[model samples]
Target: MKRIALLMVLALSLYSCDTDDDGPNLNFTIAEITGTDLPEYFEIGESYDLEVTYELPNACHQFSNFSVNPYVDEETDSTFVIEIAALISYDANITDCTEEGELTDSRTIRDLRVSSEDYNNYQFKLLTGEDENGEAEFLIIDVPVGEPEPETPEENTNA
Candidate 1:
């Protein structure tokens, strides 16, 4: 019983040790996709690079990554929700963080092969902001997609 009590004390002592606090406090937010440079049309079974532009809220907010989420509203939708995922580091000394400007950030969605065979277009919903009812408002863009080119057969008559 004494050995058990000693082990409990050791575990408590180890848990009370101080941890290093060298990193800043981080918070995350989903920024709006203000601009996009996409092709006029997309071909099925083809891959393309998409460029999105957005601005950070302030100096403390750093561009971390792009959040590309897919949504399906119906049977024919190949919808995607695109936004900028930012890391907001809270520092008491930084005060000039509210200036919003056009800062172009580049990200590539490589090899985007839509699996739906019947989708006629690609829908992108950009989260513009929240409404007065606290619901998300989106800037919807629908880009038409062309049918995939038919594959040609080889000119060999081998059975």
Candidate 2:
């Protein structure tokens, strides 16, 4: 009797599920990167803050997250290509997203650790909007990797 009751409840629950349609529909949109703040060079084994600036497509759009991917060039032994993009999400229900000619500035910082594996230089490709031909554009930045410098002790003023 208990087994039959459990099976009946499960069947009812499956039939009454509105899981497919929640309420507001959300979609992921890629934001164009405008600028970046970083050091001229990165010290291996040290972490540095990389600031990025991007523009939202519309007022309804929001900052979702960051997507970064790395690709190694076959022609170069130590060159690495890093692509960075800002992911924005907006609800499809909001139809008043017509804030044209103006953009909302958004900034995000990421802690990038310099690794020895990325030997020579890091070619950062910041994602920008596509052109008239639908070709994607990127703001390329190259940062060289430096060897670890010797630590120096500070002199005590109390002496």
Candidate 3:
């Protein structure tokens, strides 16, 4: 009877250990846009680099791939709007689940260009997943053709 009981316990242990493991849950969070040296207003025909600072759930999470999708809307001769969709992927390997501490990653925007046009504003949608249903954030900014000129006062004429 003791031998049968021991065999049953061993079988249960083996069965429990055989259960499938999906993987570690890795995620990304955008901390901030660190730099791109972008001016307050963008100039036409000028190229700019966009840098972003992001945070990972832990050190085990590593970036795998990223992409940006732009949709041009309200097209005109000199002005238009572009809605940007950004996606980031992470290495979800379960084998290397290490220290549980926050990790930061920096990345630059690639293959994105701004052309001279009538568009003065842009919107960005940062997606956290491949599907359209995951977490998302929006960022909007204005693009100006040239540097803004300082206003001049005509006080001398009144005096």
Regions more than 4 Å wrong, model 1: 1-16, 19-22, 75-104, 114-116, 147-159
Per-candidate TM-scores read: 0.63, 0.72, 0.52
lDDT string, candidate 3, 3-58, tens digits: 99999999999998975777655655333222233357766677777655555655
Compose the digit string of candidate 1's lDDT tens values, residues 1-159: 999999999999998895966555566676655767777777777777776666555545666766667656555455443333322234554556664654545455566665555666777776666789988777777776774567798888885
Candidate structures ordered by TM-score, highest first:
2, 1, 3
For model 2, the superposed segments whose C-alpha errors exceed 4 Å read: 1-22, 98-102, 147-159
lDDT of each: 0.63, 0.82, 0.54
What TM-score, to 2 decimals, does candidate 2 have?
0.72
Q: What is the lDDT of residue 143 in candidate 2?
A: 84
TM-score top scorer: 2
Top lDDT hit: 2
Q: Model 1 TM-score?
A: 0.63
- Candidate 3 local Cα displacement, residue 47, angstroms: 1.3
Q: 1-159, model 2: which lDDT tens digit per residue?
A: 999999999999998985777588998989989989868778778887787889887777888888999888678869888889888898987778765545656565556777776568888999997899988799999887874466798988997
Instruction: State the local distance difference test value for candidate 1.
Output: 0.63
